[model samples]
Target: MKRFLVAGALASTLLLAGCASGTGGLTTGSVDSISAVEPGMDSGMVTAEGLKTNADGSVASDASGSVSTDVSRSVIKTASVSVAVDHPLEVAPELATIAANAGGYVQDSSNSPASEYQSESIYVTLRIPADKFDAATAEVLALGTFVSSSQSESDVTLQVTDVDARIASLTTSVDRLTALMANATNTADLLAAESALAQRQAELDSLVSQRDYLSNQVDLATLSVSVIATTDAAPTSQSFWDGLSQGWSALVNAGSVFVVALGFLLPWLAILAVIAFAALVIIWLSIRASRRRHESSTPEE
Candidate 1:
């Protein structure tokens, strides 16, 4: 009986040890799987079971360690241009039309009237589709004399891939938690699974929002345009007739200004004349008074 009891105790210990070792192995595998889904990991060091080369030579994967064949790149494009035009108001509508024809829309626009020092100008912000960015920019450049232009492109491929990986990982977690909740046999286990699910879902929602914002940026290109109305008309070599016409117009303008200025001074001129006359009258009266005094002093002369 003692031997039997000892044998039973030894078998129980071995069984418990085996079960613990299996559970530990499973835990380690789970951790490695999660790490494999993270981006920027060295493929040589990490297992490539879940990742596959896409058509564009990029790596893509999904939940459940499955690789996808579809591949795409994300880039954010932006441009700024300064142009000189004869009429900013006229150019503003032309720019709007150009954007529309290129499958773009005006995001914002402002027209400033001419000031003392600055000429009339129009500023336009446009959102064009990625495919139409270059063509639209070319058309906009054609609208007026190009003063300056600059374009920039930013690669967001790695950022997008990272976000996708995180989203996949979170989705897997949510799935696992759902399974846990379904299999829960007690109230405490059920409550724990539900709480974990809620947390993961919230995180997933946030990541989704971020991904959407990035996607929009990739899809649309931004272009800012400044159209300044030229203060002076461009200098051109002119024929004698044209020069003569311009000279006449200038002369007429100068004469009109002179006449207007003379009109403005007329009131002051009248006031000055009235004061001069009053001064002469006073001088004459003083001279007469002096003569009377001289005669009175001379007595009987």
Candidate 2:
């Protein structure tokens, strides 16, 4: 527990505080350029018709009107929570509700039977909004004793920016390809332009889908919560032999006490010993006299 506290303190001091930093956003590429590529020129043009690549090094008079934009990266927010509750079955749902009320949802749950010396344990993963993560954790701790907990935040800002930039660049490529395909007089040129346009369009679609996924991750922070409940087990009763063993143990203990008392009464022990010896001697003499009298009478008869 002390180790956990120390780690937590260090993390708090060293880790970044905010979900975002410096208007923290995805990294993005700058617009490279927008230039007209003539039929004989080796340049690229993004236009409304289709993607256009020049055969040679010349600029088309109409290519000057188009502009270029770069895609940016996406940033994601993440965290985790783990705790052992005294009553998992009873407390887990309640805790889940608390988390829900705090703008979180249970992601998953696990359960196991009671072990030889422990109660049933249940674990649940709770995902909450980034802003409510702290409150959610506190409410869970209130459900029962806290065994352990931890939290972390990762910077996906650069990744997000990169995906966005890719999407923008692809979208621009698709537009240019479409423009060139429309203007092509040769079937070969038209086919090549259409193929390029399709490729760029597909890439754009993929990037946009990636962007949406990243957006969701950033919007919702994920936390994993685990709960364990203490359960009552059947008590084991002592058997007949067990009772006998206990009785013997008590007798042995009493004998030890008696020996100890004798040690403390050494003077009294000597007096008791002398008295017992005198009593035995008196009984012996009386028996001997009786026997002698009976024998004397028999001889006279």
Candidate 3:
């Protein structure tokens, strides 16, 4: 989705333009250096082989091989958290307020009602300014007892750079095409130039839009919150009504189990009952027939 389907003629044009201007590349025009840790140094100090460390503790190399010591990085951050709260239904509003206070907004949210076996829960997605990500997360999670949380940071620096390069190349290409259209001589060349310019312009606009979207994502961090309801007090409600309610729930659950077990055994029980009745009927009929035969075969007494 990052790269568009550049047309054949457009590709050729870009290639020739790149060759002409020497500007078609995806690199950030900087050297990336690797650093390794050497024992016997400071516990947290990192040393690069044959590289000079400046006063600010930045690494540098020879003039012929200057390394990027302060490369700007683009990162997208996201997090998910689940916490047990006293009031799950109110979590969304409180979370929204927190996000707003932190220069953020709630994108989506939902509340679930309490169930027989499960508690009420709230699910919300938030977009907070990246600078406030940690603070907002802390404030939100502090709303309740922290159950669990996880975070992820995606390194989109390379992607951002690539998109920027493509956008720059497209812009240049569009400018060149615009100039060509202005000086086009024949009708055929004009029409072709117009069509190509339109295509390039559209492509350039799309890349610019994508770049903007990517930058927005890097600037704002996303947070997903799952608020699980829990009573402030355990061993709750010594009241008679509460006891009765709990007992009733248990009885209903036990009754449900009994009903299921009965349903499962009903068919087998019916079959066995029918077989027993048939056996009894057959024995009784045989006894009656034998008695009649005996009477018939017996002499008058």
Candidate 4:
């Protein structure tokens, strides 16, 4: 009996963990021949035979161990990318078109015109089908110089399983609570059931919302792209004045930067100058006094 308890606990823990990772949910559930969940049923209610996933992804179960996990979820892929192109404003739409071609669409987008301080930029958020994620990303990266890119993935399989289990538990609980309310002869019990029912309903609604969101995320991958206008290519030809004006600007910018740096260092330089002057005066006085003492000690010459 003790060994059964220990093994059951170990098995349940491992099953829960394996189901949480998306890789094992489908296989784990298949191996367990647990009864199906029906209306007003406890989803996690294990039977006399439930399966546990081993470290090697195999299932192990005996007559004494069973747990129910009927839910499975896919991976959610999200990415953030940045690129530099000749015309950011133009490239934004091209990226949208790429998504459309791949059976996806743009979720959000914004464009900023060029300014004196910075070039034009556009930000876009695209929703692409999971299968088309890589293709769309490659298209985007190819549009211009790939400045930076990052991507991440999330497996909501565990969360879906948890919420489903909770919803099942609450459904049955609500049914029982409703029955109690219907049979309650007193006001207190009736009010208590009503309160519990309301709480359960609220929680159930929230779980449904979460489940829907995860499902959407798993179906469609999200890509956030930032497109910035690349620096202008060096002109093939330039007039003399163009070169002179560019050189003048460069010179003026350098001078201005130098002046700013000098401004910051001026106070420190002044302090050092005063300390050096004082030290020189003191040294001069000490040398003169030493010479007088030497001449006096040498006798009248």
Best by TM-score: 3
Prediction 4 global C-alpha lDDT = 0.70
Better of 1 and 2 by lDDT: 1
Compare candidates 1 and 2 on TM-score and give the better one: 1
What ranges in model 4 sit over 4 Å off?
1-73, 183-186, 232-249, 252-301
Model 3 deviation from the true structure expressed as Cα RMSD, one decimal place? 11.4
Per residue, candidate 1 scores C-alpha lDDT tens digits across 89-136 of 788888888889888889999988888656888899998989999999
Error of 2 at 203 (Å): 2.3
| Model 4 per-residue lDDT tens digits across residues 24-140 | 322222223333334443333222223334435455444666532333446899999998888889887798799999898999988889986678899999999999899899999
> Candidate 3 lDDT, tens digit per residue, 204-275?
676678788889999999999988876632543489888999899999999999999999999999999999
Q: Tens digit of lDDT per residue, candidate 2, span 1-301?
A: 6445433433332121111111223322212222222233233332222233243523344446553333223334455454555556777668678767987678788877677556787777777776777777778777765566676666665556546545654555555566565556667666656665565566566668878877778767776666666323222577899789879999998998899898989989899999999999999999999999999889654
**Runs in model 1 lying further than 4 Å from the true structure:** 1-70, 232-301
TM-score, cand. 4: 0.56
Residue 121 Cα positional deviation in candidate 3, in Å, after optimal superposition: 1.8
Measured with C-alpha atoms, the lDDT of residue 267 in candidate 3 is: 100
* C-alpha lDDT score of every prediction, in listed order: 0.70, 0.58, 0.71, 0.70
lDDT for position 105 in model 4: 93
Go through the candidates in order and give the C-alpha RMSD of each one to the true structure: 12.7, 23.3, 11.4, 12.4
Stretches off by above 4 angstroms in model 3 are 1-71, 231-256, 259-301
